[model samples]
Target: TVFLTTHFMDEAQALADRLAIIADGMIVATGSADELIGAGSTNTRIRFRLPETSQLPDTFEARRDISAWELETDTPTRTLHELTEWALGTETELLDLEVTRRSLEDVYLQLTAEAAEP
Candidate 1:
């Protein structure tokens, strides 16, 4: 077993198989990167732009901005598949599609912030 301490989150995520966050001289959180990120209420977000005239399927719950729509779901694979199928069926185009997940840095910051809170 190897123990390493560093302020670089990317390095820790890359090299460590398991990680424990120490805050206030105490162990605040411990887990694999995926486990730590998933433990928080962090959902994968799918953001895209569709034609103003087009409407998304009812199965997908999305919020719309001026020209874009965003969907947050834990099941990104199935949600993406369903979205693509629906788009293909209706010949609608999804523009500027992006999928985002909670990163190790995000989880680390959240944990440290919580630890600092009174």
Candidate 2:
């Protein structure tokens, strides 16, 4: 397994076979995107035909206090729950609700962030 430090999340995911994440010098998490997402990150991005688009804010403003926006999450189930709950509360109707898993990039960013700390 090769561990590379990268600011671009996509680069790390493309290069890695398996991901190992350590934060604060502790083993925070480890797994393939599939494994982690399968274990939970199953969320649906609901797009409603509101006759106009309300561009959702970035993670910083949206999920700052949630584990989903944290450096890493051990179990994505709780995080996924939080994401859906937040989404439902924000919008009126949820259409095109496609249940999704974590992207390789998201997973890689977490791993890289963890690997970067001194």
- Candidate 2 per-residue C-alpha lDDT over 1-118 given as tens digits, one digit per residue, 9 for 90 to 100: 4467655546656776666555556666667645644443432222222213443446613332221222234434664465567557876343443334466555555555757767
The sequence of per-residue lDDT tens digits that candidate 1 reaches over residues 1-118 is 9999998989998999999998899998899988888988655889999888888866787988887898888899999999999999999999999999877887888889999999
- The candidate that achieves the highest TM-score relative to the unseen native structure: 1
The local distance difference test score of each candidate is 0.88, 0.49
Candidate 2: which stretches are off by over 4 Å? 49-101, 105-118
Q: Which ten residues in a row have the lowest lDDT in candidate 1?
A: 36-45
Instruction: Output the number of the lDDT-best candidate.
Output: 1
Model 2 TM-score, 2 decimals:
0.41
Query: RMSD of model 1, in Å?
Result: 3.6
